[model samples]
Target: MLKQAGANAWFHKGDLRRAQAWYAEALAGMRAHPEFGMEMWKVYKDLGDVFRRKGDNRRAEEMYEAAIQSAYDYYKPFKNRELAKLNCQLGTYALESGDLDRALAFFQEAMIQVFPEFNNADPAANPAPAEVYTESWIMDACAGKGRTLHARYLRTGGEADLTNAARCFDLAIEGVRQLKQSLGNDAAKIYLGDFSHAFFEEAIAVNFLLWEKRKDPVFIEKIFELMEGSKSSTLQNALQLNRAVIFAGVDKDLLRREEFLRVSMAEYQKRVQEERMKGETKDTSQILVYRKKIGDLEREYDQLLQKIGEEDPRFKSAMREVAPVALSDFRHQILGKTDRVLEFFMGKNNLYILSFDRQHADVRALPLASGVYNELFEWLARFQKPEAMNADYADFLQTGHLLFKQLFGDLAFPSDRPLKLLVIPDGIAAILPFEALNLTPPGAPPVFLIERAELRMAYSASVLTQQENWPVKTKEWVHFAPEFRTGVRGLSPLLYSARETEGVYGMTTFSGRSATLPAFLEWAPRCAWIHLSTHARSGGNGVAPHVEFYDSTLYLPGIYALRLSAEMVILSTCESGLGTIEKGEGVMSLARGFSYAGAKSLISSLWEVNEFSTAGIFSGFYQYLKKGKTRAEALRLAKLDYLHSPDRPAFEKTPWYWAGFMLIGVDGPVRHQSPVRAGFYGLCLVLAGVAWVIWRRRRSAGHSSLRRA
Candidate 1:
């Protein structure tokens, strides 16, 4: 304790060298007396901190590694909060070195350690003690993560980075609010500290970046909202509403909830059937009364659920509904055509939109006829395939010109300033690469849509409006390469997958294994980045696709059962992204299941992939990701690399190899392991080597005796 005090005094005085010396002495003293019953992990950590401050990063890392290794060797589990703080320091060191990718990775690792639920696990089942996840620690990690992403966005100009950063800030604020609500005003004050203000400043800065990019007043209003600090209360209310909505659907009486909803639905259906059967004889007043009664019962049922939610603590974070943000109230954010927001909706028969600015909403039918739009997209998907590219290019171009004219004719965007299009596509249009569409006039050279404007996608405008900041974890890769049986129908040898996995694994700390059924089930949840190079066939509605392995098959349903917790999952196989497209649920592909299971991003092929080209392109993608590129940018660069690699023929340069895969989720780089940890593992290898020599000698002696006999 005296040594610790001396180190602290030196650190506070800015005498980093003295602090390091004192910490080293403390560690040595503690190590010398094993019967003292005191742990030296804190001393090691302090030494690491002092070394880091003194600009000796190598020693700092070694000390940090020693802290973890020593604790493990002594059979003492480091408290979760301690682990988080240590990782945060490591991330800070990485940030100082300009290794933004490595920094984000460490920050994410800290976050997951703090909030295990973020890893897609039920916290109750593997609960951390209350002291293990302090409100302050969570806030710091979130703020740190936000700052890292904001820095990355500045460097890369990737909108996703800023958007994700915004989310981190929201989560920090949310954490504070949850603490305050759970512990009451007086008790929660202890946890609040300066985090609220820090979060506010960081949030304002991120919103400023977003506002500058889109020139939207909404972001500006958000900045003001932060200053006022009323948003937290509003968010808490939304949380309550969310709980009400979720609980309403659940039957309180065991199986009764489903039965009750089912009975109500059945009655409504029966009423409709009776009206149809009676035709003119049906009483319109009675039918209206019956509908009113049903509506009243539903309202009452929902109200009861809300009341129950108010009484329960567990349902606090459960979503009740999209925290209500009125579209009319949000109109002030839109200024004019230069900063307009258009949300497109594709129906079975026609297309429509809610195109608006602060002043007015141009809610009307799109001029593009249904038949033409459908036919164009169908051809577009077909044209993107390698085998049909030569024959389909002319068809694609013809349809592309018509699509360009019809889609953009009404929305007159300015040519001088950059147009930031927040696209919300539906139906087949969701997967369509709008940027690649040919926009050149009839009987003119090709000019793609991407050249005209910058595009960002959102599921709904509400997603942006109700966005709350959350912490993200470090990235790690988990790849699966399954061996296939010969003569299996549609099964072909994908030897190049091995090359792709090998190159990607070399770039980062990898958790790769054979695509056996057991291996996939075990590793899928723990890994942050996953790549599966195997045969896949997407199933129809209610039927999920299966990923084949030499030992067994992993069906889509099986994926849902596992906790994913991954940042990205790459399905490097045929038609891996295709699934039954539902109106409200989006596409239900293997990618979708992984997304549901907790994967934040996915790289899936729209069609079959060329094995050799895929290997090279995938390797290039990992290289780009390592350089701090967003998933979309990395994938784009990979395609460009493939295009320029061998100066391939025009037909080969077509969309087949490049455009087949699409990124769907938050684009964050994978986690990187520290060299210190690697060194520790190297020591383990040395011990193994010694054991192997002993075994070899014993075997030689046994062989000599056998020869004598």
Candidate 2:
């Protein structure tokens, strides 16, 4: 126990060397204390964690195997929660090492060990957890099996892989929901931590894979439902500040106390900051005191919220009220002339695209993995950089031509009408600049795909569906262009932001201001549209994206605090739309963040932009919008305007200048209905009502005559 405990302490503190030494000592101790019972098993499991942290996977495998043997030795049946936990750990190891079949077997065995009666009876009959629902080991096991199956599917294109993957994820989700229900209000007392987040992400992802493979809009609808499930599980209000509030039936005093703790936490943070800034004080005692105060307040606040939820069911009902949009409703609302949509759904082994017009929809698969897509994306990302524009153009053009042919060549293009493409990029494809793809022959003058067709982009087809009926109120626009004082360097000033704002101000009723956090939070939600012309700092490898303002930054985690219903949000900053790409979670970009915050349309840059050229494109986009063009069409016309402008330079004509921005979300004519159509609908309804009354009266008169005879 001593050695195992020491190893866990060191591992959590990130001291890998000390952790390894303690784990080694624990292994020796386990041999000496052969009769140590379940404690011996824990030592083996802890050792495995230590080895995994050290990247010695072979040793980790041996440790996991020892843990399983210890579990068998202790329990007669060897079908306990401890055994399940050990098996799940092994499954995780195998999955990480790329042994898909082995991982799936281990996960399946673990699931059976935890819920042996799962196959015999309905899931509702076994609502209670084998150990405790809060442990989440079973959830992890199911998610692991689903992920491994999906991986194998990518390799073999097996329909069974998808079927089993979907089943495993569904079981896990149902189990969670059932457990929550069985617990009732007591469910609020349990916090499963980040495992629940990962579970839902995997669940949504597996269904997305099914949707991509099957091309059934029903699968997409399932995705929407799963997303709603994810949101419903979140106890804090997304629209308001990240705080838990008492529902109608709950005691208001609970909320009042919770609010007080939040205020106290904020005060402690402010005091800590003030103490740190006082350089004269080499004594940081006050900062430590304030930090402890903040921690205490946070714990108290959490407890208060939990109590409120346990006291009333209305809290949960209020949280679950916001559901995801339906697919059928979205399909029926698809109204546009040249609007063609291409939705990319990336699986572990392949990429899928569903292309559709107002009248037709079809699905196609791209036989490319994340590795291949990354290679092509890296090339495109490089080509879009300002410094790379002057380098050898042949390789860039060749790569462009290759990608263009691969992505669009198989799809049937409309022969009669002009094509306005709305590209919904997925996974690595989020970083791809689709408009830059070359459609010209090798060695011919560069002719970009944007020139051949109108192109816009989207976060997801479901997001577009959600925005189908969003009314564009055409209110005043809010523009932001803040100057940097620190943490940003080695870049020329965006003088064009001022020029761009000036042009926009003249065209419409607009309010332009410095991009400060306070000002942004105040103005963003009130306007119909927002355009930020500041800087953005995007993180790689599964980190949240953020936009840097004058005094502070807005991160993905905090974006939900904003209650925005803006028609559009334009992020004119560098890579503002790029985010951490996770296999099952999709891209966590600023564009997605804005969409989640209730923006109907978004314009984001996949890469950095040329300030002057971006200014011109912005002007043209607004001009087209004012003239009643669809959001997608307006962006296309803007890019074309930039490409063909008489005052533009040769470099400006390249896709690098005009293709950085992409429109994502809704795509259709802005002003489709008028007063005449409204009046006609009213008249038709009146006539139908009159005809119904006449038919009912005639039927009644016939019955009366029959009775008289």
Candidate 3:
């Protein structure tokens, strides 16, 4: 027990070498004691984890297999979650190693352990019971089998293999939905959704392949459904829940109960977190107690929410599982006549671009060139180092043009005017600055892609279409600019932010000592637009990404707790748009946190931005917003204005200064004035005009009569 504890301590501290040695010693000690036989599987699993983390894939697989063997040999009933987990691990190993038959066998065994009556011969014919679908192991097993079958289809070009793969993926995706529904908290749901991203990717890939082979619209429809169902789903759910509480007219008592339970759960979670952070000296018993309390609270919360949903049909609809909008409906209802959407899905070796408009839907597959990913990373690195970009301008320009050709050259666009393009990026494509790509001929003067298209991004097509109808706040703008001159928490003072905030008209400003996290939280929800000019740190060194305010830091999890109704959030901070990339879920950035908090649109920076340039650009951005320009157009024009400014040095005109910021989600005007309000204002203006005209006519008549006399 002591040896195992030592192993865990080392593992938690990220000393994998020492952890591996300790685990080995522990395993050897356990093998000598017959009473410890049943517990041997745990040590082996730990060893597997250690090996996996150390990048010893071969050793990791062997350890995982040994864990399964130990479980079967000593455990009374081998059909258990632990055994299922070991088998799934082995299955993933085999799949990655290209041993499809072995991978499928291991996955089948995993399913059998979970269901006990699971038939590998006909998995689709006898699906796991709905209640059992909440076991994430079953979902992983199904995804593994589906991926193995897809691999087989790729090798043999068999339609049967493809069809079976699609079916398995469908079952796996359904399991994902059930699992998410079973969770009581958004954090847990987001974790599960992020973990299950690969399943969605495989599902989309297989269905897209099936569509290519069959040429059926149903397969295409399924592809769109999967895309919408997977991408940024947690953000969508949070928005929906807010809508349910606010607009669905849910009972106040029920809402209060739900809030209490959530808060209680959060307290318990915090306790557990604090205990775990004690490292080698942590109190296991206290941690377990806190976990149990959290679990109890979660169950109670789930029950209360279920009751509320049952009592209110609108709540049920709002909180219900995500359903895919039909392709026809998406095209006709969601897309405008001039709008075009390019949704990219990056598979292991192929990139699929689904392009659609109100009149057309087409999918194109591009086989990736060798080392293309490395090239992309290298290209992005140049943006951070302006010296490198300036040093090799020719190389940079050539590479940029080549990337443009690879990504967009094949697409046909209308030549009448610039395209209103909505981009849905996946994988590494999320960080890509599409606007920075050179679109001109190699020898011709540089013309950027942004010049040819007014571009904005969406998490998914469904998210884009499902616009939340939060009540408009009376206050138009709220700005925060925190001075970090003390250098607390490694943040530097933003010299230009205070001036920048002052430049904006009709905004409630919080600066220096007053720009605290608590103050922002209290007033942010009451405003239609939020602008935060502060320092932000991206996630690293076991710390979550956060924005540093005057008083304290607000982490990503803290951001999730906020209930906001702002139409736009401008994060004029460094790397506010950067975070840990969670496959299908997009970047877990501060910008995404605002989205989860119900902000309709966001303008955030991808990298550490030039504070001076950011201030100038955003000043123009607000002015354009006041002119009622769309968010995407306003951002584009703001960057353009910066580029055209003769006062700026030529060296600063590079994309490194201006291309870091992106506009995400809805691209509508900053404040959408209600039609009724607009009509009333119009009536008042007309009445005032008539009164003036009548007065002018009476004066002219009086003057004419006097002249006649």
Top candidate (lDDT)? 3
Tens-digit lDDT track for model 1 on 641-703?
776667776667666656677665454344445122333456678889999999999999999
Give the total clashing residue pairs for model 1: 16
**lDDT tens per residue, model 2, 1-709:** 6877888899899998998888778778777877666677777787787788788888888887888888888985646877778778788888888988788778877777777564322211222343325335667667777778878888898878877777777667665655554332212413432235556656566666777667777675566455434432322123222212412445767756765675566456545544544567634887777767766766776677567667866765554433444545545554343366565665545565556665665555566653457657556766556568547567778777878777786554456744667676666777788878887779898777776677766554444554654544446567777644333443345666655545343223222235677888777766676878777756553234677666665666456445566777888888877776644334557776677666777888877777778878887876676566777778888888888888977765777888788877666553433222333456778899999999999999999999999
Give lDDT: candidate 1, residue 73. Answer: 57
Give the clashing residue pairs of candidate 2, or none.
none
TM-score of 3: 0.77
TM-score of each: 0.47, 0.68, 0.77
Question: Candidate 1, 383: how far from true, in Å?
Answer: 3.7
Worst 10 residues of 3 by lDDT: 671-680
| Model 1 lDDT-worst window of ten | 120-129
What's the distance in Å from true for residue 171, model 3?
1.5
Instruction: Give the per-residue Cα lDDT of candidate 3 at 473.
Output: 49
Which residue pairs collide in model 3, if any?
none
- Candidate with maximal TM-score: 3
Q: Could you tell me the lDDT of residue 147 within candidate 1?
A: 79
RMSD of 1: 29.5
